[model samples]
Target chain A: MDLNQTIRCIVKLGGAAITCKHELEKINEENLETVSSQLRQAMNLGSCSNKVIGMDWSKRDGVLDISSSLADFDDQRQFTVDFSRFVVVHGAGSFGHFQASKSGVHKGGLSQPLVKAGFVATRISVTTLNLEIVRALAREGIPSIGMSPYACGWSTSERNVASADLSGVTKAIDSGFIPVLHGDAVFDDRLGCTILSGDVIIRHLAEHLRPEYVVFLTDVSGVYDRPPTDPNAVLLREIAVDEDGKWSVVKPTPQSMNMQVEITVAAHDTTGGMVTKISEAALIAKLGIDVYIVNAATIHSLKALRGELRHNIPDDWLGTVIRFSR
Target chain B: MDLNQTIRCIVKLGGAAITCKHELEKINEENLETVSSQLRQAMNLGSCSNKVIGMDWSKRDGVLDISSSLADFDDQRQFTVDFSRFVVVHGAGSFGHFQASKSGVHKGGLSQPLVKAGFVATRISVTTLNLEIVRALAREGIPSIGMSPYACGWSTSERNVASADLSGVTKAIDSGFIPVLHGDAVFDDRLGCTILSGDVIIRHLAEHLRPEYVVFLTDVSGVYDRPPTDPNAVLLREIAVDEDGKWSVVKPTPQSMNMQVEITVAAHDTTGGMVTKISEAALIAKLGIDVYIVNAATIHSLKALRGELRHNIPDDWLGTVIRFSR
Candidate 1:
């Protein structure tokens, strides 16, 4: 529990797990509390180094009112720039896609991050959801900031924000805090703007932080030989990142890209399946750093990999531990 | 001014006309008061029946909260029920489309209306807008009701409503109150659902009432011989509702159905415009009713029509009052 420990792991959480596939209305405080406790434990597990748990916002509330955003953060004097030790790249589902689409308006139209402005009412709801997340995080003593790609000016020449000042995350981490980020749409060089998935975000971070290991905690048990949907699907406990990425990889359907991450853990009940994370892991593992893919239920595995938990035990065999030879 | 003596007109107010479109903000009260005053003067000038101004809502603050709807009717005990004198067919812009597309789920995707379980967020917005409109009408001392085609059903086989059980509207109007309706997608027998417009509500009413003179009002000046933007355009003072429906006909594009109903009376505007009024006029005018097309600004014209302020008699036109036969 020493605060002076050097951090070893820089874990990026997928939106599905953090937002609980958005099933619990808001952040699913029960799950968050549990995840929060695990993250805290992992952070303190090792006297070696303090780990940073980053977030890839699972969803965003599009209907943010200046008053509400201000009121929600006003007394505490919190603003859009107040993310924790983690830097973030969040999504706009919380903003207005609902309203924009309702009006048959897809502003960019099949372009990067596919958004329209007509869904004003839906944005209103998303705004509520976004506030709920903020409130829950705040209550947990976790300071979180909310951002949307449509409202924020983070884009690359090809996309919107290439390296979107993930500085919010880095600063949070540097300040001895847990920086939380989320899956987002970033300006892209290739597609004008592409979804910066939680896994993709880790890929982005790997280029910058060069951390020893990147872990993805999700609801699913782990990666599978085939789609987990099938009754006969078997769990693939472990695999070399490069070996599995090329010969075996699954593409995401039109509805989602999260499921297409190279190699990561997944929840059985969430929208994005293991196939998506597998893709993300493969992409990050290529950077020569190791990745620990595990169910959020057992985040201790993350701490174990960080040399924090000194146990050699592999519980559940329900997770994957990925590493690089470089 | 005696309340009952006020000339009655059903003004279908567009959500855009009254709201700060993207900001989701209400129109300021000072401006609203002026608009309401102009409405009163217009009422005094017109021979039309008691006016019932219906608000076409774009958003609802809450289901139980009807504060915005009751903006103008501060004098009486405002009553709100899901009852209507007019079968208002309202467009569900900023509520349905973007949310549907965002969820990658469509219930009644254009091919029909309310066909799917749909997104929770989209449904909330739709319901909220309905409440706002209904609530506004009630506040104005106008007995009002909210109606959605999903609840009533549509004639999918013919891309229309075979029969809208508009018992609510009938009861309201029969009680000597104005019935209001708007554009809306309804459950259909064929396409599974179809969108019925507010104009059609008037058309159906015409089939029943068959008034001697029907009035049409809207945002723009009356229909013109050429596009209004053209320099040589001439205002179309008289529109012939003929067998072919060549004149007084408006069509809907994917972007907007409002175009067909944009005609209004010129400066010196009269009562406000009802977009589908022209189409309704076409349907009823064919039955021998003379429909007057005027803008809300033409106050003097309304006074002349009401036999209040006399129109100046031109010396050259004194003995030239020859009636043209249709």
Candidate 2:
């Protein structure tokens, strides 16, 4: 898999999308499978540079070296679009948020012995959830390797991510494997340990890797003018980055509902909720990256994320699209 | 939990000790429970300086601020033996070996797509096993936080572990939480990805942390002159590191076996063999650190590793003790 030939993208599955966020540690297998399928489709529809013939990942001896003549024979055939590399990040959702909130781990004091224990409990729960996500992706033949933020991420005294060595993630992608990362408990200099949000991780990765697309797959359709639950709520078509590299919401027409900030569903999340996600997305958009906030629960929304609906979709797609204002 | 006041130790449970390495992915519940019990006993017996009362981790609101005067009053009491810090590392026996060996992951060279897929398979298997260990320890009232090496370990171009950020492990120990590490597949510049043995991890950690003691709990009694299956085979009680920092075997008695090199059971390990473990241990022993290899299957051996038999036992202990030549 040549890194240069890969159409790099980051697809972050919201905790609510793959796991039962309302239920502690319960995996939403159906939703997980759905998301995995869409990701597989995305992989098959992108450009794969190293699509070698006679390469069977399941068979031990099947990966034989192809002769030059055989390579020429393969080159004579037309190839389908397929992704050469991808990075998948998921939210902690029920697994981490429940324990983190209970322990106040998101608040980051971490001096008390009891709080430290809570940090352990939260880490265990979140990693367990990570296992499920990896399994689902594997079942879909994504070859997703689970990566932990705690192991590689270093946080400053203020409990912000100082550095995270994503070289492993880069290597996995270069090797034609999906690297699955999630919200996790990590070391903090001042606080003993703290939670690094998946949103923050995606934003940082998109800025560094400069992926062509960044997708946030959530339970809702997209960002709404008001809480989506409200009868008069209207979904926002787009949230754009200004020429000055500042974030601004598309002004609402009388047809759209009026609301200023993002209204995320009430959950155990301590990482500033949906508003934070939107803010992070906007930051990525300012870098000229196309960011999508879509409802993975519906197949249409997932297809939009995979660009399958790009040909026939209206300007107001199934989800909110964030890009540069011009 | 003051870092300076704590007594730290790293205890590694071999895959053969805690799980049925002979059986694919089958955990030896009986062995796991036994090891957990011994570890719990060891914790309670070690010196603990700050054992607080009225604290419960499961409860959300129980972590109240301790009155300053009350803390002073509580501080006046004599403290008993309890380990203040612990880091547990375990081997990936059945959980990883089968897939790793099949994928040739331990031998490195993951350029092949199939080998890269194998890396993911091995990580999932090892992490799954790690969860079992964490759950068992938690059931025994040990607050064990699962730490994935893939998250932190970085290998040099030569496939040697160049750096593993142990800040989280240190923080976990300092805060009185047990961080459980295991053999894992990590990113390597030379090989793309490679297996990191638990023994090597233990040695690297002991050198950096300089823990008071490091114990390896395995299925066998200790290092033997030959395979323990041989009817006439005998255990070599001790292997000493000379003053010159070189490893040397103690002369066998008339009743003991005379072989020098370590003889490990033939399993699916690709990260070298038993010889690798003994070599790594010898390196740590040369650093003036005490290293113990004992059969976790026997309570007596576990007790010996915990130093419970120190009062009545001879300088040469029941298990294989590796230390600098006296």
Candidate 3:
């Protein structure tokens, strides 16, 4: 079941992006459908990356049209991959955050005996959500297997994943089935028990599996400066790690003041919020892997992430790209 | 959540005991209800070991009657434990056995790459059964937390449980919630994946937790001299490990010809049948713990195991007892 070779991308469905985090145990079905549909289209594209090697479409007089070079390829015929080689990891969202926050399961370390109930409750919540998402994907004609990280994930004394048996995951991917995993309560050597966030899991997986791309489908369009809520807040389209390993945001200057920031402020997140996501993404970026934080609220955003709507390039996409400069 | 001291018993609901193993995905609701009701009754009997130290009832001509000795104790009152310190383990039965057997998951070793689908299929089957049992227990007013062994169970290269984290299980018990676990597809170092039987899981748990009693509720009355299916089979009421640590069963002789064999022949059991169960129980019995194998088709058997009906001891009970002689 080893899939380290074929899988080129890892896409994560943030809990807040798929479920109504403020509502108890509610799933945002519309957003979920959009995400699933996009994944299907991307998988159908067959070995296509967002690199945009050759121009297939051109724009003239503000009108986009297919170029003569596109005549050789049938645009409507979907290309199939050797296999759909992508792993789907999801956040706990409302299913886990409430119980984990209430019981401190996410905080880690030794806890009071009563907190044990919280761990069980949180597990039930998240696993239930995992099943629902898996079922939905199955309805969309995608064969997905739902698994709890607790089933094979282990944590170290420091409460980070020490050894994770990903054979099952790799096997599922190799067999052309999507392996769906979610945040779960895992045993820790030092902490007794703790919550393993989906964000952290995706990063750990990328490091080991070496996927070429990692996409985080979130509620917000992308990472914003100053929490996005400020009137003057602006979206940072491209963020990269400098030679010194410091993060820098590509900003519009006097050379391009006409460009408007397209991102809105991030809503409140119980699971470390957007700040934590960025920091985790940065670490993956240092590995020379591309990470995208894109909103799935609109179909256009999905297209951008799938590399299907590449005529506009970075300008047409509503997301933030985090990568390391060669 | 520490329960190393509080929990004194471990009860396992064999898949054959609670579900129709011959039928696919069918649960024996009647048997399940009886088992749950009896467990509820046992939990209500606080500090009451099988010893029945202070009599709550007296018998007159094969009839059970409340005695004057129980006048001080409220007959209607259900005394709760400081904590409901017991763990309930269940087998996968039809849900897992079919796929595991077909995939050779129970056969412990490296497998063909194609067996990966079988692993995922088996997980879905078992976890579905686990959720069903959890829901039933919840209906019986038992706060049972459902967990898969894959969540915390690890196996050696030989496929035996190498390192298992029972902290959450212990915590669940210490918090007064029944920790319900079931056989599952777990990652193995030697085998890419293997089946962790519920029978094996119970033994591993007892070794770590050192519970005072272990009750294996099965479809049959108890262990027999030969396969219960044989016509001349006789129930072995009491089995114990001898000086050399070999298992031996008690049988009636000419001098005790008046004694009657109380167990009936065991029905079909795909999970290694009753013989495997007895072997596992014998190992636990050698550790100074009492193990009971009783039929769950009747409420009386459950009551007998719970010590609620204890007039005739081993002689009156319709089951086999495995213990170590001092």
Candidate 4:
């Protein structure tokens, strides 16, 4: 099998991709296709690294949600499971936080910052759900599978281990497959359990895959210097996340303290996400990994680690970059 | 689709069926065939109950063995995904426990006994592994799926609703699909995070599903008069578990005092097990539900509750029925 030694990119389809809560399904679709194709084209031209794309969500593990998905028509919607170029990992936000609390380690201590009692199972639902959605996608021959703290190992406490059955993605990658991963609720030791978002999982891979760039594909066009809703808000070309959460990292527009960098990271309550992603990516950056926090919906704007463009776009309009340095 | 209606059975294939510490491949094919035939037969006989069988060591949740399952298959195969008939919660025992503990959770205490620091990732792995196994089983067209505690109304604490979907199992059951659950380590309210077992899950289900007969399928035949190791240990025809752990109603077996039911009543460190099964069955009996505690391995001599041949058996062999009139 010819495993490409060039730039390997692991694309994490944000949770927003599935819920479409306030986003449009068509928009989500177009962005994902563009992202997939761009990654695929780069890999094909030997211009990219190991390519992987994952579907991510935190609240879709409910039984009803999975059932309702049964009626979804096979098409790009099927791309979620295309194991060839993508390995999917999703979240389980809505499955049973109440039930988890009842039996979770994070018992009581509300308003006490972040509690991890039910987080492990919480994150796991994300990782497992991603696999299922991918399977649903696979039904259409999208060639997809997954590996998480549960399956392979994007673990929270210890060293990450590659799953023995890498064939799922190995074959796909050999055949130009795109592997996927997303934010997940993985089992945590200190606090019972925890969540591993698509951002972190992607960055985790960046540590090894050493992809040219890692992108956070969300619904927004890109990080705004200020709140998009606020006319006075400014946009950020790029920002950095201090491992200690001491610096200010803006998201184009800071909608709330949660949207911008804050004291405690999102890994605690799992709400303040950007800070967590930056911190995690910073760790990967020390290993020579660079990441891109972009509006995943705009795949045409993905860039290379060397600041090369994945798409033929005007330099002025290209999205921002967040490089990690030692 | 014409769904059949008749006497259907929910059978639990032992964990050994899917995962063996020694040779995993040995069990897969045989088990699949054996279970497939059994399910088909149960379906043809009656479909009302829904003949469902799932892997205790579900692929998604992973496995959790207190001890190493890497030894001989049956020697001390203590680890398996133990959940309810709805969700197959799994875990990777030795592999994950270390990882979870390393992540850190204070294990022991004074009055609470030695709190062996358990792994936190265990909670995540157990649930995810089980979910994956459920999906795997479902994909194989086993008409089975895994359930999470959130869907089963397991809320030890308040609030913190799970974002993941859980209604799939309810739908499957309503659609006549047999939902399977296993013992998973979920974040708990009281005990940081605790392990859940299939036995406990079934016990919990008895509170609802109220099956006419609750049978535990084990590797051994049935309750032995003496320890099976003694060769002279005769099989106890029946032993009833009373409401209070006091089986005063029936005459104790010859060596009854020495007989300790191997089960953990407390939910913290232990999962529901054989000892807990009887206790739970006692509750079921109170609801006028008849339960059969038999070693499923010896099911060749399986006796249906309605079978007439049982009339010829000795009263003791019939079972020490503990009536739950309350």
Which candidate number has the best lDDT? 2
Model 3 TM-score (B-chain only): 0.79
Assess the local accuracy of residue B284 in candidate 1 as a C-alpha lDDT between 0 and 100.
62
Candidate 2, residues A1-326, lDDT tens digits: the string is 22544445788999888878766667788988888878877776644443422211221122322232124432322322224467899998777776677667766766554455456667777777888788777655567778877755546445667777767567567666677888987766676567888988898888778887888899888777656776866676667788676665673443354443433322312433666777788888888888888998576566665765433446545788888766
Interface RMSD of each: 19.5, 7.4, 15.5, 20.3
**Cα lDDT of model 1 by residue, B41-104, tens digit:** 4433423434333322223332323233335544322322212222233333344434344332
Give the clashing pairs for model 2. A46-A82, B45-B81, B46-B81, B46-B82, B47-B82
Per-prediction DockQ, in order? Answer: 0.01, 0.23, 0.08, 0.03
lDDT (10s digit) by residue, model 4, range B124-150: 334444554444543333444445442
* Per-model tally of clashing residue pairs: 121, 5, 3, 144
Ranking by lDDT: 2, 3, 1, 4
Candidate 3 CAPRI assessment class: incorrect
Cα error, residue A29 of model 2, in Å, equals: 0.7
Model 3, chain A: how large is the TM-score?
0.80
Local error of candidate 4 at residue B21 (angstroms): 5.2
lDDT of 1 by residue, A1-326 (tens): 12223335656544455553433223445755666555454444423433221221122354422232223322332212222233323233323333334333323232211121112222333434443443344333333433332222234444323545544344334433344444433334454334444455566666666655667766666665445676755555545545444523321221333343333234432545455566667666777666666666464544543444223435444565554333
Who wins the DockQ comparison?
2
User: Candidate 2: where is the Cα deviation over 4 Å?
Assistant: A1-7, A46-82, A156-159, A243-272, A307-316, B1-7, B46-82, B156-159, B243-273, B308-312, B315-317
